[model samples]
Target: METPERGLLARLDGFFFVLAGLAAVYLAYLTLREGITPGWPMLLVVVFWVLVSYLVLPRVHRILSRVYVPDYFIGRTRTADGLLGDPVNLALMGSPTQVHHALRAAGWTRADDLSLASGWRIVTSTLTRRSYPQAPVSPLFLFRRRQDFAYQQEVDGSPSQRHHVRFWACPDGWFLPGGLRVDWLAAGTYDRSVGLSLFTLQITHKIGADVDIERDHVVATVTAADGTATVRVLPDFFTGYHSRNGGGDLIETDGHLPIIDLSRVDVAGAPEAALPVVRIGRPVQTVVGSLMTSVRGIVYAALSSLALIGSRDADEVTAATSVLLALVLGLGALGDLVLAAATFAGHNWSRLLLCASSVLGVASVVAERLVGNLGGPLHEGLLPLATSVLVLLALSSDSAREYALGRRRRRPAPADQPS
Candidate 1:
């Protein structure tokens, strides 16, 4: 299959991605040193695990994967951490709505989109052995984003044991490796138990070794539910192989590929899982941007307070000028804090304000550089300047903008609703 070529903007995004990875490495090293210096052995070990698993190793994997992993349609899914995830062993030909309809008819429960609430719900429900029929699946990426949707079937009323599959809508004009046209691709796996990920040491579900069983199970259920739907197989679509998934569980699959034709399935109701995935929750850029804004505001507030305190007994002219400057700084700091909170709450206006403010800050630095007046930390383009630019880029990103827009569109004044 032909690989998609990334545009200039996409290349620019990769620069930022690599930069972030490097910065995370430095952060982890610094924290590890500090923790060790304190001589709290257990704390140091725990802190090291937290930093390494969540930050260091993922960044390392990302950098390495970009260099080695094939970017084309490889009939496999990738984890967020850039590890090769479950193999894609199934295909479908139908509109997303029809696909969802068939799956639901087959008695599959639509998995909840992964979010803070659903994530926590699954964790607690698993601990209590309570059935969470619609528990969210951890995200696995395809087509450069997470799965379009997922469905699951709980076994024996156990939250920990289930049959689940993640599906991705095929990109337009995209074809399978052998020139076969398909509308969607999927990875089906059975979660046997909860265990730690071997690659990253994170607690996650462990899958059964033989994934062919789950693939057959999905086919059986879908076709059994809808008489109109039919499936055909592609023999030896991939070389049959045994491998380990990202979570370190063994996975073996036959080379067969099943294409479920859902185009003929009847549909009469609003499709549930096929809706645009806008409600997957806030993007990471927005989260990071809000955090940086809040930190900047707090720093400004602290400095302004200190300045006012120190100027209390200064000479008359100095005291008056200092107090006025402090008050102005204090007001600006308060605005920053408010904007940060509103941005986190998914307010587009607040995001714009933050982005605009960062633009001005960047512009001022450029202006000073042009006049040869830049010096000190800003002169060296140090952390403060870098932070401003990052905040600007993140708040102005497409993901952040789309998320803010989606949130606003979903929420409307109560009076505007049908009474």
Candidate 2:
């Protein structure tokens, strides 16, 4: 994955995601607490929480991660949508079992998976001031999915705060700079408190401002537990610096990626076979993903438009307006469908057309919002607008642009013969 130079609008859009996320989370919490009464009030809060946590926040992450996170590993961990979540300050070279042994020996407990049972357990534990050493940590995505495993150590027996690290198994055939091979990449952060983020205002773990402290803490504990454990800090691996995470929590780090090698330690019976390597062009992926976003936006817009037909203005609405709206929505969907087919077939113009359409759609949404003409429920307009922006940004990426233009060099289909 590659990150192109970000324009001003893109930067603002990226920040907007964080802002929107914080707002949503706060609203959800307020709804849950204030709406907790008998009957519908309680029901509404539950629904709001679910919608914000599961549906809305995930989408926000998807959109913002692309802008804030580096596409390539620059000694940092990336969120699901490509935003910088935490710095990848630690690396381990060992089999999965060996890693387990080392961490367990270091007195860290494996965190429970984030499921309904575990989630509820953590909430109750936090509220009741109970110890939950193996409490689940909220997952941050890497390699297109959540961390393969996580380990955490409770601080002062408090369920609300802990030292945690998430580890992801390295992709097959992938190597770090200088050919350094690490089995697992990790991001370690200390939860100073359970609180809302300063920027996003979302109810999330407020990590200690200095992440380097936590990074060294992990290395120290692990190394002390096992005599065989050793660490080699890649000097200035990420460069000594201070930064902020996606939640806008302050963080300082020495850019060095600590490489811990425990390969010699025997744990599992035998090492598993290396996974098969799969390769696909990043640009092609952008095109396909953008097409999907376009389709989603088109559908939302169409549904919103149809919903508006029931308004009192229906008496004054002419057939032309209805027909025009239907035609536009149909065309938008049809365009994305065609672009998806053509882009997959290696047609370059289709990619360009897709990008053009995305830009137009986003512009239209902005225009409507600014003029106070956006109709239907607020979410109806906001959701599609957000999706359009995401699609536009994806299509504008360097990878997408290069792929589109690079493919254009193929000689035109034998025009005379085809005709």
Candidate 3:
């Protein structure tokens, strides 16, 4: 029999990535149109700020960050936007089950996974000052994957304030800088209050200035769990330094690291058979790129449909030519849509096909502009060119390449014998 389905959603955030850029441009165009209007311009500017900050800036940062940001271990976590997020001040050497049991015993609650429902719930809870003990924490990346899980302690029934720690399982044969192998790595921080993210101007929780305090707080909590957990402090794992995290909040740490030994901790409910499941998902760039390809397909289909519809009044030869062109373009558009769907489903071949076509599309447009002396860097019909560029960039992104290759490598093996 076939294995049970993971039933994973093919979430191609790349579609949203391109949409954000398009929205930003549209908002800017609207702002220009209302430039002479007094109050409306200001309102539109704010709207633009909200959209650009949350959507466009993050993706832009992710693109640019690939150039300068080193992917090697830096004893820190990177934000979703690829900025240095939080310091890695804590480590662990225990099974995930023990860690879970120990943290719960120490009065920490495992946070809810981030989703549309949880996101809305947290927003409402924050606005109403309601206590949501299991509120989801924002993701941070280590080893190129978001934290496996996070735990938090809400302070005083307020969503704005909390003590949270995110954990990631250490890869095979990986260890600390000084050759100390650990089962997991963790970063802990205290959310003092909510404020705007300085880097992107998005609303976020401003962390406390000193992270050492939070690190110690985390170690203390776990050690206080009825003599179950023990701590071994690695002094000066990272040199004492002052720096700002991705959100641009002032943060200072003494460089001391704590390795919490949860091996001796108490019982858990069941075996953690699901902890090692394949974690393949559509990357932001790949999804956006694929969607952009679909947009091109839609455009082609629409143009062909219009051509067929308007060809009625033309002479015999003209009508026949129009019908032929329309049919050819329509079939090509249908194929493009199929390719996009396959790409979004994590097929490497489809992803590569989109990339190849996007390259040709962008090159052809630029070549036409240059050959025709169009008096601009690019020719007219900038929207078409822009979509092609987006499809090129998003699909060509490092995340997209990694996602495609990872998915390919992790695919199930074919059976030699039929069931």
**How do the predictions measure up, each by TM-score?**
0.72, 0.55, 0.77
- Candidate numbers, best TM-score first, in rank order: 3, 1, 2
In model 1, which regions exceed 4 Å deviation? Answer: 1-16, 37-45, 268-282, 313-419
C-alpha lDDT of candidate 1 relative to the true structure: 0.80
- 1-419 in candidate 2: lDDT tens per residue? 32453354345444444444544454455445545656656666666656565545655666565566566667666544455778888889987778888888789999997877998999889888899999998767777656887899998889888999998898899898888888889999998888765444456788897887888999999888777888898887667878888677888876777888887765655445332243334454565555675577567467546845644256456655665666676666666666766765556567556555655665665566558664333434445544554554455544555555556544467756662
Q: Each prediction's Cα lDDT score? A: 0.80, 0.68, 0.78
Top lDDT model: 1
TM-score of 2: 0.55
Ranking by lDDT: 1, 3, 2
For candidate 1, the per-residue lDDT at 53 reads: 81
Model 2 scores what on Cα lDDT? Answer: 0.68
Give the runs in model 2 whose Cα sits over 4 Å from its true position.
1-61, 67-69, 80-82, 268-419
Error of 2 at 258 (Å): 1.6
